[model samples]
Target chain A: MAKTVHPDQRYLLALLNNDAQLINEIYKKCAGKVKSFVCFNNGDANDAEDIFQEALVDVYNQAKYKGLELTCPFEPFLLLVCKRKWLNELKKRAVLPVTKEEDSLLHIGEDTFEQAEQLEKQQEQSKLFLKAFEKLGERCQEIIRWSLKGEAQEKVAEALGVTYGYLRKKKSECMASLMKLVQLNK
Target chain B: MAEDKITWTARFVEGDLSEAEMAEFEAQLQTDAELQQHLENYRQLQQNLRQQLAPDAVREALQQTLGKLNSQYFGHETQVLSLKPIIKWASGIAAVLAIGLFIWAPWRGNLYQQYHVPGQMLVAERGAASETELDKAASFYNDGKYAEAKSILEKLYSKDSQNAQLSYYYAQTLLATGRVEQGRELLTTVYNGESAFKYDAAYAIAMSYLKTGQKTECKSWLQKIAKGTTHYQKATDLIQKL
Candidate 1:
């Protein structure tokens, strides 16, 4: 016999399947809980959204690859996920000496220490990459930033009001310039 | 590797080469030490550029925008409603109008004359239906069906000429579909208008311009949006990214 999928799983699947209204409704229902969790972790509303987004992405990845099986109510499960994400973020920020107030508020999951360490390392690498990115020319900086946002060459060309061929050449030149700058700084 | 190959290496790291060119470039990277170092340096520089350009103010502004969205859609308990009520009310009104037109001719005539007959009614119905269509388009967009959403939004825009919301969303759909010029033109109208979506339109137009690589135009439009109330946060964020 096939295993039965839980309501939370069904709801999440529907959300991941592009039911925006339903997803919006779910957000409405649990946003407060997520916000509270973030606040407890010394994160503001922006941090709350970041945590929510990250949790959603995590859930999406799980649904896509692992076929996640939700064994609890969606509200609690979502809150838990968001809580975990926010706590990890806090740990990375080195908000240090995790206060008893935060500890009391959190669910105190098993993966906390491991995830905290991982997040700290990732944050460190990101900081280094960002430091390296700062040495490029203004134009090169803009091109690379837009490219990272996944803008296409043709679109970038049109935005600059240049020919597609020219834009491609410029992008390469900008990258080369950036490489030179980084090498000089190093 | 030769110095000429080293220069092309920059294009390869930036993903600016065509597929065939990329294949050739990758083949070159396999054996070239100087080219590899150049590529690594380029990657590091790009990362640094992002760090330098990402303003703290932009992040704060995004947080504020998220706060507003939360307040509007999530924080306010009274506003947190199921779609059923709005759907019920719209359908109810539509049904009443339909019934009145068929059965109560005198009442219908009075309303028709007051509202300019079937023309106005048609417009109203079209407006409501267009909103529904736009909602569908948004769903399609979130689902990554940019072409389908663009087609629907375009059809809706054609039906309703003065819908700033539709125009704004249509422009977004166009941008997503890689029709940058058309998207910019459509969004420009909304951005120039004094309508409710003006700020959002301005911000989106700026983003579209940035996507197309018009840094100067994008900055100008972003400035306009940043000065506006409704889209200040988003505009600020885009400005920083640019």
Candidate 2:
């Protein structure tokens, strides 16, 4: 059975579905409070906009990677995410970091906030995985990349001037090798 | 053994295993802890790589999506924050709604909706206007103090039982309070009697029927008012709506 979708989570689905109209609604309805929070905390409109976009991307990635399920209203969840991202930005820029939040945002339950942290952790993993991928051998990187892109094994072998059986074998070895490198990097 | 493990893990991740092989792979996954860990790590690597290695087109789309959000939040908001433009647009819509209500009001279907701006009654009788009970009732009615006006009108109505203005305005009070039956009876009496409010009373009765969800009776009463009468135009519009 299809799960009953919450209204707030509709924004996340819009991001996933690439529905421009509904995504536009997310900006129209929810960005005002976020802009207020950002501007009040020594940031400008540009900063707020950047934080909001990043928050949205984080939500999208969480839904894609961490199976993020929204359990509260979208506005507060979005506000919490934007606030956290802005504080992280502030910390990155060497500004005095914010520990407190607007009472409205803080009132949402712990898991939603934890979801934001989880997405950030996933983001860190992606960054690490990319760096480790670059350290891999050329054939290992190409095989992994092509396999992900859904390029046929026979076609990849043809392009690399190798047999299909050898390509699969090399691809497997590369996956195992890539995991080892990622583990070592961590 | 290591090469065999690597090959099977890759095929399993890629769904390159056939039915028998996939069944065997599932059985091994259920029992073999080390192979399960390898599969889990490979899956995680696949997820991270798929995300980080997003195609150039997908990356551009993501940027464009963010740009769309940026323009909506900041660009439009900056214009709205100017206050003058927002005020201008707001007052413009208000003015347009006012003109719209004035020019094309009667076609509004609901009786309560149709009766938004009350009819012009209760003319000031020279110097007797302000201090008189009639003026007090008019003032109360105009100010939306319906219950107060109804009390004053009912007392005034008992004194002058045949007064057209008294009957009409008092019945309007009843209608406003959702007492459609009482309002309809008073309207019918004024409509039948010789009074200046005869046409108006007919129209009010029609309005009362509409308020009571009796459109058919409302239409019949509305159709009786003559063309040159004060309420003929409104009545005609209401009949068409019915």
True contacts kept of each: 0.31, 0.38
**Shift in Å, residue B167, candidate 1:** 20
Q: Which stretches of candidate 2 lie over 4 Å from their true place?
A: A1-5, A98-106, B2-8, B11-27, B56-62, B76-242
Q: Evaluate residue A157 in candidate 1 and report its C-alpha lDDT on the 0 to 100 scale.
A: 73
Share of the reference A-B contacts seen in candidate 2 = 0.38
Mind giving the per-residue lDDT tens digits that candidate 2 earns over A1-186?
Answer: 644446678777888877788888888887888888888887988678868877787777778666777766777678777888788878877888544654544467665666566777887788799888877875677667666666777887887778887777677677767787887998
Candidate 2 lDDT, B76-179, residue by residue in tens = 43322455545655665566457546755656655547643355344334332137678788778867777888888987774444568898999888778765
| iRMSD values, candidates in order | 9.5, 13.8
Candidate 1 chain B worst ten-residue window by lDDT:
B115-124
- Measured by TM-score, the strongest candidate is 2
lDDT tens digits, residue span B1-242, model 1 = 23475568876765667799889878877898876876775564554444333233433333333344555543333333556656755775577466534643444433212221110011122223235555677667656677897788777665444568777777777777766665776777787678977876776676665655687787788788646474575456546655
Query: Per-residue lDDT for A100 in model 1?
Result: 43
Q: Name model 1 segments beyond 4 Å from true.
A: A1-135, A142-164, A177-186, B4-8, B13-28, B31-242
Worst 10 residues of 2 chain A by lDDT: A97-106
| The best candidate in terms of lDDT | 2
